[model samples]
Target: MNLFADIRALVISALDALAAEGALPDGLDTANVAVEPPRDPAHGDMATNAAMVLAKPAKAKPRDIAEALAPKLEADARIAAAEVAGPGFLNIRLASPVWQEVVARVLREGTAFGRSEMGQGQRVNVEYVSANPTGPLHVGHTRGAVFGDALASLLEYSGHEVTREYYINDGGAQVDVLARSVYNRYLEAHDLDVDWPEGTYPGDYLIAVGEALKDKVGDAYLDQPEDVWLADVRDFATDAMMDLIRADLALLGVEMDVFSSEKALYGTGKIEAAIAALDEKGLIYRGTLEPPKGKLPEDWEPREQTLFRSTDYGDDVDRPIKKSDGGWTYFAPDIAYHYDKTQRGFDQLIDVFGADHGGYVKRMKAAVAALTDGRVPLDIKLTQLVKLMQDGEQLKMSKRAGTFVTLADVVDLVGRDVTRFVMLTRKNDAPLDFDVSKALEQSKDNPVYYVQYAHARVQSVLRKAREQGIDVSEAALAGADLSGLTHPAEQALAAKLAEWPRLVEIAARTHEPHRVAFYLYELASGLHGLWNLGNTESALRFLQDDPAHSAAKIALPCAVSLVIAAGLGILGVAPAMEMR
Candidate 1:
């Protein structure tokens, strides 16, 4: 069903035939050859660069190779013409049956039409939204959550065994601060005057955890010292905050396959083992780092510390694994966490991080590279900040989550689907301005609304077809006479459908889920464009006077809905059966 791939295979066969006839040099590398949609539609339906790539390698002029190869491609039943364009580019116009077959294949495959086997069921671990479990998830974490969740779904759809993971930052000092914050709220629940201290969480979300702590052990810790109750309170508060985080993620249709705790790595041989593994590779040593380039920190001093030779694997400088105080640095646990992932037997790893963590990317990648000896590849995608606005005014902090807008607040205002879709409308590393009013509006300016409206329109056409006594089932439409679908608009729509499978493979290989969102928008626009064309052209309408003709026309919209549903499913957004 991938017309591009089929055409490329034909070009390769033609090249092999040419080489056998001694018309070209043998063993020419065609791996770089590509078949794709031509830049200008006027040129042809497809274009290939086979002749251009093989020209220098075969010691022949590109145009000579193209002219010889064109005749061989024209002999194929699917190719109407193969013209040599500009030096060596082969522009091909496909026969009408090629476009007709695209519609039929879409109907036959349904939602599985665009599914790819590029992954070959390889295991992939995607870790994201690894926020500190101190309070409800904030606006920054929401972008990572949506992006990571969508990426996991996309990999799964492309035939990878994906494990969605969240690495909880409960091992850090933040949890102790959370425990103290909860204790203050516990005192407030007991009617005692409690002063909110600096470095402690002040969000109202912790007030409930404080009250719950009071209910669980009333007056037990009222007079206890910090040493006596710090452990219990930290565990209690962390559990409560984790529960809140889970609810927040659920609001956006996100659920992790695994919740790994950084605290669990402490005192457990895991950190030592990960560092020891690097040490064996001569990557770990005790060294003093030079002053950072450009600007020096006020506290910068020469201090001996345990460092990982990250520069060996492409980092700018080796990074510290242990601070001067002899305790593990933050990077230590991260390295151990990735090592654990490697031990789990993943063929590849992807980490979705906040844009602020840009400095940590190279070191982390180096650690994984040194640990797995480059057997596994790690791709870290950084999601930039999200700016939320409403009614042309910037929204400020949320009192509930303390400093920033909580994910819950955004989900409550618009909705889960709208929030998820809007977060992905831009590239992950690019900042996004999320306007509440614009997102909720039912207009083309809003991609979520526009794409959903297209799906609903297709459903409406199908409903109308059913009511007109036409058998609009996939079996009936797939078997209809698609040769009548020869109109330019109809043929163009089918050609767009042919790009889905190839797009899926490209997106998966690049590990960019935003590409899927962009492609879905383009596909929806194509459907909408065709639907608008039918208003003035009665023959372009989905329902016709003859039942067979109506079935054939309705098949195109039905395929559109199927592909939209599949694409939205990858994004974790439910397809709209009807626009509200």
Candidate 2:
């Protein structure tokens, strides 16, 4: 039901026919030809650049090629006219019934109307929200979590076999810090005074993990040394924090298919195996890095460490796998995790990290490049910081003040739906402002409200139509006399409906789910425009005096609601059936 693709295929076949007649040179590369909507609606319903692309290759003027191709295109009933533009552009005006047919097609397909097979069930792994198992997730991790979860949903809707995964960084210094923080809480549980240290987590959220540890093994490790209790407490505290993370994600309606532990990668020979695989490719070496690009640190000294020749794969310099103290660097476990992903035989990989990790992108990409030898492509998306505002003032999140915003705070303030939609309104690399006041406003200025209102308005029309005894089921609507839907407003609404399938393909191809959110807003705008037209023009109304005529006109807006529901579904935003 993709009119654009259908027309593009027609243009390609027409070019093949031209080659058969020797009208144009045989084998002029047509891969670059594009069929898209004309910039100006006056030009035509669709436009193609086939003639222009084949002109130089076929050794013929573009106008001559367009003129020759016009007659060939006119033979199809769907194309009303194929006029040659300034040079070689072929401007096509589709018959009114062509777009009218799209409305009926949408009604028949319902939410499945714009679904695409572009992914074709190829396995894809998307790793996001790899936040360390510390306290509750903060604002920054929320953006990445929403973005990655929505992307996984979008890919699955478009037919990709997607795995939603989170990499728990528990095997790091941070988790030990969490353990010590819990240790302090454990001492606090024993009614003893403890001073909060500088490097330990000072958040109140860890107090519960401490209390729970006291409940599990009450006062047994109260006076024990760090070595005697560090491992047991670290394991217990990390598990509790992960449980908290899972609950926080559930608050925002997110569920990961897998939770990969960095601890599992350690002591399993998995890191060794992954590093050895890279070593087989000559990517590993024992070397010392030159001082960083500008000034060298005062403590900088040349020291031999286990390094990876990342520069060979386009990194700025070689990377250290093991620190000078004979322990793995932070990147060692990361590389091993990605290697695990590659060995799982996924067709592609996508990592969603915070934008602060921008410097690490080149090295990680180089690691994947060398590990898989470019067999699997890795797409890393960095989510920028999300700023919080309220009442014309910056909302300070000082952990010491116990005033930091948690994911639960945001979700509880407005809602999970508003939180998810607002986070997705901007690109992953662009900063997002989540205003508590503006997000809750019930006006068009808020996209979450605007798009949801559109779906609700359409539902109102359908409910009214059904209450009046008009059959508005999809089966009945599919058979409506759609040709009666010829009003300018009706046709404009139909045009928006045609863009859904194309939008799905574009969003999936680029791994950008935010585009779906943007498209939903535009679609809602078009719908609201048509709904408003009913105020001044009687014909623009969804339900007219004539039941059959009203059915035809009603189909357009109902289709609009259907596509909005689909888009909202991908974004994990619930579509409203009535404005609250």
Candidate 3:
């Protein structure tokens, strides 16, 4: 049960009563009315804009409307007082039983307490970590992977049918370069001298792929030239690199539901079909793009090319779909891939890209809008770079990746849970400084540790209660006499728990999973504060003098543990049962 929503309903009922009594005009649109926590806690528990929203429509003054509505709302059993504040805002203080009931509701619902149906079962496709398959995923891709996976989980928790997908960039020259790199490694596997090419990959990770290729083909391709081996090896090497990427993702607890291939868009009529759909709407044309604003390219010359009229859909300029050579440009396959997603009957599409791809965002959205005719909404989230640091210094390049820190290296330095939680400690578009030493520290400076310690603290309390023969099962806790939970500390915790259901909807609506991480930290902070409060107060302890009082007191911590577990599950981090 959402206490905020329940209170909002009560506010709406009062507004309708005012209209019925002719204190307000008939048919006033209350859709803009909102009930939320007041800005200052000293003001009240909740605040509403019902009077301000209806004032002009009802042809009455805002404060006058608030005065009429306050008396009506104060008559309700749940509302203790409804005071008309500063203009037309109504600041409400709920009765003591209301906050006490929130605890019982949490214990009754457990982890499902904050799950929302706001999405209404819409199909959502979240595509993230579509890194080039030339090598292992780097630290930048790790942030995108964690953010996308958490977003997918948050959408699912909010009642969406989420499909986690990865788009493989295999239809480019990068795969050919990978094939040549593997060929050199294969020659080295045969104990032959080979010169390393300047542009080829030199990572040690390819050594295993090269040796595996030798095991599979034996001496069949040993004497073959580049022409004979390039095609076969390109396909073979791309597959091997994808396998390595999959294993790397698994190390971080990420598994995609779909892996769409860029190469698959070719040889199929999909590219042509997508373009034709846009062309039918007069969105495709052969035109020369103007030189980029402010600073033109050194080779900037007017050349006619096939372009998509992306400017029609709010893009800065029309983007080329075909190069001067008539071959498909880099964006052609991406257009087709998004068109395919639109045709798959998804109501919403979300792409998680790196910060460097910020320029691609407008064009991709324009293409999807032209393809779906604005029926399907597309949201592109750009995750900024991650600066990997250890002990006050930046980590060096990975020997396996040759130029960047591999995702596997980070996971090895810190376990999967630490890696996942620390990655989300910052907003996606904001740069994150991930210090390995700080992330693993068992102190409040470590957000992951601080949150997990709250869960562990509750577990320790439950274990102590169990040893004392207090029945702390969920069934017993749900029936506890929570009326005695009138301490200011206990009430403050229940207030924090009431924010979960509201926070979930806000985070899901904004497509920001980092908000969940932030909320968990705040909730953990509130929980830890209450735990410290029990030091001098005998009644504040979980183990009371009476078993009945203990049951009532333990219920609050149990609820805190349940909410923390639910939040951690959404972040793809397992909750700690006990802290070391």
lDDT against true structure, model 1: 0.91
TM-score on alpha carbons, each prediction? 0.98, 0.97, 0.98
Candidate 2 — which residues are off by over 4 angstroms? 297-299, 398-403
- For model 3, residues 1-580, the per-residue Cα lDDT tens digits are 7788888898888888888887877788888888898989778888999889888888889999999988888898988899998888999988888888888888888899999999999999999999989889999999999999999999999999999999999999999999999998899899988888798899999999999999988877887989989998999999999999999999989999999999999989999999999999999998998997876588578899999999999999999999988899999999999999998999999999999999999999999999988999999999998999999999979988889999999999999999999999999999999999999999999999999999999999999999999999987998988899888778878888998999999999999999999999989998898888888888898888899999999999999999999999999999999998
Best by lDDT: 3
Ranking by lDDT: 3, 1, 2
Query: lDDT tens digits, residues 1-580, model 2?
Result: 7889999899889989988998977777888998898899779878999888888889899999999998899989988899999988999977889888999999899999888889999999999998889888888889999999999999998989999999999888898998999999999988999998787887888788889999999889978999999999999999999999999899999999999999999999999998999999988998888887676588577899899999998999999999888999988988999999999989999999998899999999999999998899999999999987877676767452265678888887788999999999999999988888898898989999999999999999999999888999987888988887777667767877897898889899998999999999988998999888889988788888888887887888888889999999999998998986
Model 1 lDDT at residue 21? 96
Backbone steric clashes in candidate 2, count: 0
lDDT of 2: 0.89
User: Which residue window of length 10 is worst by lDDT in model 2?
Assistant: 394-403
Residue-level lDDT for 411 in candidate 2: 86
